[model samples]
Target: MMYDVLIAPFVEFEFMRRALAGVLTLALGGAPVGVFLMLRRMSLVGDAMAHAILPGAAIGFLLSGLNLIAMTVGGLIAGFTVAILAGLVARMTELKEDASLAAFYLFSLALGVTIVSIRGTNIDLLHVLFGNVLALDDQTLLAIAINATVTMIVLALIWRPLVMECVDPLFLRSVSRAGAPAHLAFLALVVINLVNGFHALGTLLAVGLMVLPAGIARFWARDISTMMMVAVAAAIVSGYAGLVLSFFTKVPPGPAIILVTAFVYLASLLFGPVSGLLRQMFPGRHLEA
Candidate 1:
């Protein structure tokens, strides 16, 4: 019965296998980036970036009608543009990145909606917004896998500077010339991951698999490494469980995966070993910090 519930879906359908693979690649890159975003308290900015990619994605959709390569490139261009513009605002002007991100994403969201309304039906717009994970092709899967690999490699290369920047940006800036580049590169990776994630999860909710696991991990883990691992593990579990549930229940796979992570977040919120709401019930029982 358990095998039928869990393994049968993937074994019975090629689409299920593709869906699982696609989300797995997304989680590989999304998890660590998510942990960092949470630690840096850039959750809102990250969310905005996800939404801000919509206009480019919409343009791609209009140009190619659900071509994965075109839409991904479009999303990448849009996401990176916003990140760079936001960073520039933070650097040159007095406006913060969060405010800049909010403004840009709102405009982009409006633009995307307008374009979609003018060019396509409401259902097409929904497909862009929510994605068609079951329709992922080999090319899309390969793109996601390549993005995940590149993200992991670049992260390893800049891990030290990133950690330093996160912990003590002023100190890192004073000590090494890598601080600014590290920050920019990290943002670039985020954009790339979001772009890839959009292919499976859509522009609006791509940040779900990324940010939610990180939030859940924060309550359970003390250090960054542990948090990242936990986040990835949680994300993978969510992907698997959500897929299984979706196969049986006929819910949308993308949002189901995200909902699984949401459930973990709720569990962590109330009963985590570290800083959970229920922790107060057992005073002085803090986990390793």
Candidate 2:
């Protein structure tokens, strides 16, 4: 039963294997970014940025007509544009980060959709919104892997300063000038990962792989490093489970992966060690006394 359920799908079909590899690679690279975003209280930022990638992608479609490289570059540019603008808005105005992000996100989403609608067919737009993971080819796969590798390396180099910003921003500012640069660099990484992610999960769902796992890890792990590792593990597990479920149920792999991650997130919310509903249920016996 197990073999038929899990092993047979990959062994019997090359696309299944490729699909598994694509999502697993995505989770491995994107999960850590989600953790940091969660820690820094930028969960919504991922969503906003996801929408922000669309206009660039639409522009790419207009220019190259479904050329993968063009769309990716366009998406990267659009994502960064919105991210940088949000930062500038926060820095210069009375509005907070979330508020600035909200303003830009809505505008960017509407703009992107309008651009695509005016220039693209219904099928082309659908591709932009939902993505086609099973159709991911060798060139796209290589691009995703390369992007993931760069994201990890840059993140490691900036980890300390970035964590400082998350924990105690004022302290970081007082001690060093790296705070602003770190924030920008981190935002860049977020944008790049989201662009790469859009190829597999689409603009709307790409953030799930990053946000849900990190959110789930929050309840299970204490420190930042542990939380990141746990988040990656959870992402990989969910990705595999999601792919298997997709194989049997005929569900779309992207949404199936998200559904599995959603379940994991809900499970953590209910029974996690740190702040679960189950922990709340027996509060008297669970005290630190």
Candidate 3:
């Protein structure tokens, strides 16, 4: 019965196998980026960036009708443009970074919707907004895999300076010139992952696999490296369980996966070891000083 429930689906179906592979690669790149976003207190920026890519994706869809490369390039361009513009706006104006990002996010979302409406059907818009993971093709899968590889490699290259920037931006800037470049590289990584995610999870829900696992990891881990590991594991489990749930229940695969992460996040909130409600409610014995 367990085999029928768990193992049979992947073995019996190619789509299931493809979905699993796509999500595995997604998790590999996204989870660590998420952990760093949380560490830097920029979780919402991830969401903003997710929205920021939409207009470019919509434009790609308009121009080429769902070509993965076109949409990915569009998203990358749009994401980078907004990131840079928002930074400039914040630096030059009275508006804060968050406000600048929020403003651009709204504009991007509105523009994306308009462009999608201009040339695409409701179904196309739905597909763009909420991805269909079960529909991932070989080209899409390959793109996702390549994106994950690049994200992992770039992250490794920028790990030290990025971490230092996250922990102490001022100290990093004071001590080394790597700070600004590291920040830009990190932002580019975020954009790249979100662009790839747009293909698998759509623009709206793409940030789920990225940010949610990181949030869950916070409950169990106090260190960055351990938090990233936990987040990746959580993303993997959520991806598998979500696919299984979708198979049995007929829920949309993309949303199903994100909902599973949400459930896990709630569970972690209540029962996790670090700062969960249970830990707070039932305090441990104080250590003797």
Candidate 4:
């Protein structure tokens, strides 16, 4: 039963193997980014940024007809542009970063959808929105892998300052100029990872793998390092379970994977050890001398 349920899918089908690889790679690279975003209180910003990548992707699709490289490049460009522009708006105007990002993302999402609708069919748009993980080709998988590798490397390099900035932004800024650069680098990593996931999970669903794992991890961990590990583990498990569910039920892999992660998030909310509902409702026994 286990073989038929889990092993057989990957053993029997090459696409299943590729899908598994794609999502697992995403889990390793994107999950930590999600953790940082959560720590920095930018969870909604991640969602905005995910939508921000859509215009570039749509333009890429309009020009190249679903070419992976084109869309990836387009997404990177759009994501970076929006991030920079929003930062500038926040810095130069009265608006805050979150509000600026929210406005830009909404505009970008609408623009992207319009561009795609202009030249592509509804099926093409659906593909952009929901992604087609089971259809990932060798080239797309390679791109995702490369993106993941870059994300990890850059993340490691900027770890300390970034964490400092997240924990105490004013203190970090007072101490060193690394704050701004680290912030930019972190945003770049976020964009890159989102673009990476875009190929396999679509623009709308891409952020799920990135953010949901972090949300689940928060209930289980207190420190950043442990939280990141837990997030990655949760993402991988969710990805695997989601893929298997999609295989048997014939549902879309992207949504299925995200839904599984969401379920885990809910469960963690209810039963996780660190800050679960059960723990809150029923405190542990303590002994006093």
Candidate 5:
């Protein structure tokens, strides 16, 4: 009776398994990306790239008739192209990195909306914004696994140089020629993780996944390695909690997960033992005193 009433709903459900898998994969890959993004001070780029994938996904849907894999591929290509163009524009002109990213993402957002409207397929625009995690299938799960593996491997290989560049770019550049390659490779991995994660979390919240936990971790730890580890642990725990909540409550997984993470961020912000808002706000009073 317990098996029929309780376990069956989650254990036998394909969508539930797929949604859990999606959450796990994205949290694992995105946690490190979040740390490096913080170090680079280019965290906004993740948000911009996430938005940039919209038009490509919409276009893919229009052409391929809603094949999620094909549409995701389209989004991935579009996202990478935007990143490349933004980098080139930033290099060739004086617009600066933030400005270039803004321009690219804004243009992509407009183009995506226009194309979807013209296609007249009755597809909801909000799906691209918030994502539909419950709709994830085996094929999408496989794609996410592949993307996660590649992202983790690349991150592991480039971890040291990336850290050096983040801390002391000039010194690293003066010391070794490999810093430039490491920087480029790291950006490439960010693009891939953002695109892959978009399948579950969409543009708005996917970027949040890459920023909020890391930001929260910074409040508690002084060491970069410790901060990354803490952020990953936080992400994995909150992700699972969100998935289970969504499964039981019939809420959308992406927003539910992000909302949970946001709560964690808020707690960290206000009460983290090291550099919390409360400590900063009331410098004189101590919890013991």
Candidate 6:
């Protein structure tokens, strides 16, 4: 009976299958973006953009009445718009990028909450924050698959130049067009993935999943490529484990999955065996030498 509750849902129900597929796609799409976000020092920017998607999603829900595609597109536009506006503001003012990001996300969160209060129920608000992954429909699953596939392809194509730009933007700028095209392309992919994953994980945990696994990978891995691979693997394992746990516990999958990933992150931080927190703190002890 315990196994039935834990594993049967995934094997037996269509909704569970869709939910798993959606999460797997999100994990893949987000892991690479997280690595790049870390490399570019734009991790907070991703968080802000995720929150910035909320108002647009609420508006889309009000206008179209639960049309997933329309809502996803609305959220994507809002997220990308905020990102671009923040960039412009950063260039125009003396404020740093982090400051600009904070402003954008705060504004977006306030606006989203206001709109949802006026137009939606408390459940709607909860959905925006935490999501309902077990209720994900076929349409959403299909969209997730498509978005993940395209995002992966685009990332593969531009990975080198984007990495170069992230590592040394000044040097790249001195060379040619400075990989601006690649940068733009990567940002576009980020928007798509954020929107695609929004309904499955919500803004708060979406950003968490995006950043934590990549961060954990950074502690144990030296090379960029290896770090990315490790991040993706970590994300996939944690996501699946979380989903299965949620199935058995009859809990909300989004937070459950995030908690699992968070545990993995904590483990990596505490005992990663290379530059883990314990090793760093002790300085004389070696977990694996």
The C-alpha lDDT values of all candidates are: 0.88, 0.89, 0.94, 0.93, 0.80, 0.83
Which prediction has the highest lDDT against the true structure?
A: 3
Error of 1 at 164 (Å): 1.1
lDDT of 6 by residue, 1-289 (tens): 9767667877788888788777777888888889999988888778888888988887887787668977897898888888788888889999886788799889898988788778788988888778888888878888888888998899889877888887788888888683988988888887888887687887666686688889989878978889888998898888888888887786778988888988998899998867998888888855886
Of the candidates numbered 1 and 2, which has the greater TM-score value? 1
Can you write out model 3's per-residue Cα lDDT over 176-276, one digit (the tens) per residue?
Answer: 99887888899999999999889889999999999999999999999888999999999999999999999999799999999999999999999999999
Show how many residue pairs clash in every candidate, following the order shown.
0, 0, 0, 0, 0, 0
TM-score (all chains, Cα) for each model: 0.95, 0.95, 0.98, 0.97, 0.89, 0.92
Residue 204 in candidate 5, Cα distance off native in Å: 2.8
Candidates by lDDT, descending order: 3, 4, 2, 1, 6, 5
Q: lDDT of model 2 at residue 215?
A: 94
Rank by TM-score (best first):
3, 4, 1, 2, 6, 5
Query: How high is the lDDT of residue 43 in model 2?
Result: 89
**Candidate 6 colliding pairs, count:** 0
Give the root-mean-square deviation of each candidate in angstroms: 2.2, 1.7, 1.0, 1.0, 3.3, 2.7
Which of 1 and 5 is the better model by lDDT? 1
CA error at residue 76 for candidate 2, angstroms: 0.9
Candidate 6 residues lying further than 4 Å off, grouped into runs, are: 1-6, 281-289
Which lDDT value does model 1 have at 240?
87
